[model samples]
Target: MTSRAPAFPLISATGEAMRRLGRWCCVCAALLAAGCATYGPERPGEKIYRDVVFAAPGGHKLRMDIYVPRQSKPAPVVLWFFGGGWSFGSKGYHVNVRDLTTAGIAVASVQYRMSHTAVYPAQLEDCRAAAQWLRDNGARYGIDSTRMGASGESSGGQLAAMLAAAEGKSRIRAVCALYAPTDMVELAQLYSKPGRLSLVDKFLGGPADQKLDVAVNASPLNYISRALPPFLIIHGEFDGVVPLEQSERLFLALTDVGVETQFIVVPGKRHWFRLDNTQFAEVSRFFQVNLKR
Candidate 1:
């Protein structure tokens, strides 16, 4: 017969061909899995972004980390600055820096002037310039510049307050300040009072120095006007650095000018760290309404 007892099988060749096919399939699956893996700490509807050059103040280029939500067509933006007595702090802090992106809101964590180099209005100018950056680059960043807000803590909080109090047409929509120093003159005076509890001296320059005027120029309480934005102030009752009254004073000043402001006092908390779930949730909700579409 023509079949000739069947053809002798090339067992080794067939086996090797099957093995190569299996290996190729496995490699494809692995590549797909890698692509689908975790993008970052970014949560649903959020993304982690960085190093967006927001401005160039004093011939120096400034940068920020922006988190944009997927749900909103044109999301509201929250421009956040970190707290370090105006001498230190990157655009990363409060853990809020990351969470803001996941919540479907756009956030710009900024870097401004520090004490060792620039002070007072220098910081304010940088901040104002950051706002302008947001406004100018809103389309590129997927942000709704018309509904922008600001938030920060301690010296960072003071910067947020200043953003709200700035005299401009593109005013901030809302503000969130945590343990911010409102009255710089008052804080500067307290620096030499037997203790260094109020240490804004290094930030705005010392009271003994010509920094007194500089301090006054930076205080949020100095520029109270009806054109200010709504504010939410969170202060530790025992915050030795900025004092509880600072928030109260700023809240009152905003309210006096028919602007909306809310104050939350964290009992027994220190100048650094210690925000409970309630405080965290409060700020989160505030930003949801104010910073997210």
Candidate 2:
């Protein structure tokens, strides 16, 4: 969900911008982090690592918190991303993976460069780096690494889907996206509020109308392919922020390409709604079935 833009220093989109954005990102992250100070008491027999640096792109240190289950054998991992309209979000935001870890799955809540700090591919690149880091370092933390998946909401949802759909060696085995904007161009056009459109603008470094190529490049829908991993897409029935059609189109595109996918619309719900126990169970089951291979 988009919010009022914080005061950011004027910096050119260059090496210098990356450094400055890194600083600003920490500030925004700290503010958001305070809200998620406690995610319940730690589960028994669970191994937790916080603020583990996964990558340092352009001198910006990206981090993730890994929660490893107490399984004897190495367990599958799900890399989670957080949503903040690509402007500001913390790695700890909206993370609830107890079900996953309890089911013998590890969860890595990852942090990426926000749109206000960096442009489109930067976020993707940072996320990809996190995946690769997990692949390279997961063994040290009891993660299988071979069996990987991703899940996120809104903007983070887009990252998770794109990370899986985009062609790369680091692509995961599955993805679960919630109320994400799959089509950047459509999201920009559907914006009814002034601030909403600006979210797309700042993310793409300009208006989507002017940067059609960038907008297309940023869209997860355009990246759909048959080789992509299975997907579980959940959208609210009346999501005004990203709209239900966004997930619908992505589901259609994936299915058309012969990719395994499922679309579930939460009835009578709006954007920012939490999953009930049943819905959460479905998501947990989706990953368990698809990722355990």
Candidate 3:
């Protein structure tokens, strides 16, 4: 998710912007030379040889960083989106996604259309196309078409939930959202801190700009249905940005429709939520269970 004018530099949408992801990948790859940040396979059970590509969304391309475990056979594919409140974030923002590849789950860290240049469904559509592209060619990527999951944090979480909830099993098998937002109306109203910076204006286009109905339709919460894939929501108890309640609504909504779902709230964590050792354990475990081939 990219922000609007005067917003933080989250992600770039063009080949130039995507170059940022490639640059980061090179940096991470080089860091392994000295074993400083051994992204190859330092620890026991890790992904290796992560590569970046740009998924085409017509004129604009969505950046994708694909990771497959070193020496691992055909496995599940996991599409991970970065979080920036639908305003900022890059596929490179989240580092641990590489872990999924090393853990026998092929990971694709994708960059979608952001709120900067466009708005609403544009972002959703770009992400959806990314998933479809992966599913269409899972075999070429050494992925097991039978098992595929999606994961993201914050706004990416909302997008992840939206993708999983909106699509039938034919597209995705499971979803993992980290402190994501579902109801935009409630989120725009609830997290609107009194005077802190807010990207809602740029994301929703403000009262004087576009319209609220636009945000509603693009929101993941509005499209919850039985076609949704299994879900795993992990939220922070004190996420001032996106509350835990949003996760509750999604978890409950999915379960009501017989969709396998799980919800976990981190105790005493805030917006810049860090994955503790335990959280990492849970993260790997969750993906393993849902992304099994």
* Cα TM-score per model: 0.77, 0.85, 0.76
lDDT over C-alpha atoms for residue 263 of model 3: 73
Cα-based lDDT for every prediction: 0.68, 0.77, 0.64
* Superposition TM-score, candidate 1 onto the true structure: 0.77
RMSD of each: 23.5, 9.1, 10.0
**Stretch of 10 with least lDDT, candidate 1:** 1-10
Which residue pairs does candidate 1 place in steric collision?
none
Q: Relative to the unseen true structure, what is the C-alpha lDDT of residue 246 in candidate 3, on a scale of 0 to 100? A: 67
CA RMSD (A), model 2: 9.1
Highest lDDT, which number? 2
For all candidates, the clash counts are 0, 0, 4
Candidate 3 per-residue lDDT, tens place, 52-144, comes to 444665567566766766555777888887766555556655555556655677787778776766766777787787777776776676767
Ranking of all candidate structures by their TM-score, best first? 2, 1, 3
Q: Which scores better on TM-score, 2 or 3? A: 2
Q: Pick the TM-score winner.
A: 2
| Model 3 spans with C-alpha error above 4 angstroms | 1-54, 191-198, 206-210
